[model samples]
Target: MCFRIVIFVLFSISASMAQEPQEYLDFILPLIKEAGKELLTADNYQVEHKKEVYDLVTIYDRRIEDILINKIKKKYPNHKFIGEEESEINGISNLTDTPTWIIDPIDGTSNFVRQIPFAAISVGLVINKEQTMGVVYNPFLNECFTAIKGEGAYLNGNKIKTNGQTDINKTCFTYELSLARNEKYGDMYMYRLKHLTRVIPGIRSYGSATISLCYVAAGRIDAYQCDGLYPWDAAAGVLIVREAGGYVCDSNGGEFNLMDPNYLATSTKKLSDEIMAIERIADEERIRDAKAKTEG
Candidate 1:
């Protein structure tokens, strides 16, 4: 009957959609491990500056990105790729609805260049502009953080969840100042930091957005905030946080989008609200200061 055919077609579409993330996971997990090994062993890789003196890129970053892009293109020729190095080279600015891989071959290039061991290779898959799979591997720590949409997040194959800490005063949080990249924004972040330090038990910056988000998912840090992040810097970590029962959004509490450059991630919605409240205050003060300067 026609009705039976319609039901079968709908079920088939639903089933295929459900299976896609897992299929991508199966393809990416081993690639992540292999890339992690290369990152850990590459000692002679060249380092370079990009855009600013503080923004760094290394030969390993390019090499790993090349490896991943090639393999992915070969396997899924129709899929798109948005890699940090490639974007830097080609000036790719738009993210399409076509299935895409957003990659940060080495997230903490400064740390990696200094042999600080806090770097990670972060990869995130987006299908129809929605994040579906994420893998962040820290070679030095041998930690692999992964998430599949609708499934729970995992660290080293063990299921992980956020700390569930709601009290701002009792919680420890991370704020990545390096990503501010602009003096005014950095000043605003410092202003927030001063307020946070007065109340929170502890504050830290791991200098790696991917690791900071993974730590939040693992319950190691209660929240993290940063601005001026690229899609690759945030795509994987945001999905992992959500899968681990955490919250991620823009600075003003809007729904997170990869194209948006700001992020506030927290272990719980309550914690996120509290942090964003402080950020709002700081932002207001920054706006007031700028207005005063313009008036004067």
Candidate 2:
């Protein structure tokens, strides 16, 4: 009898430990979904900013943050949360490996403010500074993209794997237009845009980086390119894209670091290589032009 009781207790402990990560997701997803619903109904949300023009936050953003923090604190008292608003308010700090939660209460706040449904709630969990699990909920579209490291990625609870379309013309692409508004390269941005537009059959510019990456993970799009994004904006989506068996790298074709402010991601390894090759050619052209003018 004593041996049986000990075995049962051990089994119970193992079960509980295994459930922790899923428990985190289960706890957070509903809150995010609820927040999304609230956003749809909110008519009085106003822009609240940390910096007058460069950074943007909204009342709905704060409300969602409050909801997330309250739930996270209540459920996991020892866990640390790094939210966009809190980070902006308290000043940014280094991300530690202590079971940190990275959140963008509402990614694509400009879209949200303008009554566009391209916004989403992005939640990611990191253990020892490596992203382990992420969930991006777009309530307006009723799409939920989730990934657990090594377990694969899913959309709406259905398994989603990157599709195989190695050809460029058959591929679909999405680009982030946010940075182009203040594009540092001037018309070089237009050059890349023109180049990509000519190649891909479909080219889209969606305001949500997280959602855009999710689309890639789900095979809705084949690639994504974006610049000037913070960690919170890309962290969850990066994990999703990677877990979906896609390739994610910096614009220079380097390994992806979550903290890096630039990224280029694609649904297939071959597609990424091709896209990077095109980007390099365009960059070379610009360099050659600059050198020619200097010598002249």
Best by TM-score: 1
After TM-score superposition, the amount by which residue 172's alpha carbon in candidate 1 deviates from its true location, in angstroms, is: 0.9
Off by over 4 Å in 1: 1-9, 179-184, 289-296
Error of 1 at 156 (Å): 1.7
Model 1 residue 126 CA deviation in Å: 0.6
CA shift at 46, candidate 1, in angstroms?
3.4
Please give the RMSD of candidate 1 to the true structure: 1.9
Cα deviation of 130, candidate 2, in Å: 0.7
Could you tell me every candidate's TM-score relative to the true structure? 0.93, 0.89
- For model 2, residues 1-296, the per-residue Cα lDDT tens digits are 99999999999999886677788888888888888887788787577657556467878888888889888899889998878888877865677878888889888888888888898999998878888889999888888899888788999999997786578889888877754445565556666776676787888878899999998888889999887677788878999999998888887898877876588888888998988888877777878888999999
Backbone clashes in model 2, listed as residue pairs: none
Candidate 1 lDDT at 108 equals: 90
- Displacement of residue 66 (Cα, Å) in model 1 is 0.2
Assess the local accuracy of residue 250 in candidate 1 as a C-alpha lDDT between 0 and 100. 89
Ten-residue segment with the worst summed lDDT in candidate 1? 178-187
Alpha-carbon lDDT, every model: 0.89, 0.83
> Stretches of candidate 2 above 4 Å error?
1-18, 52-54, 179-181, 185-188
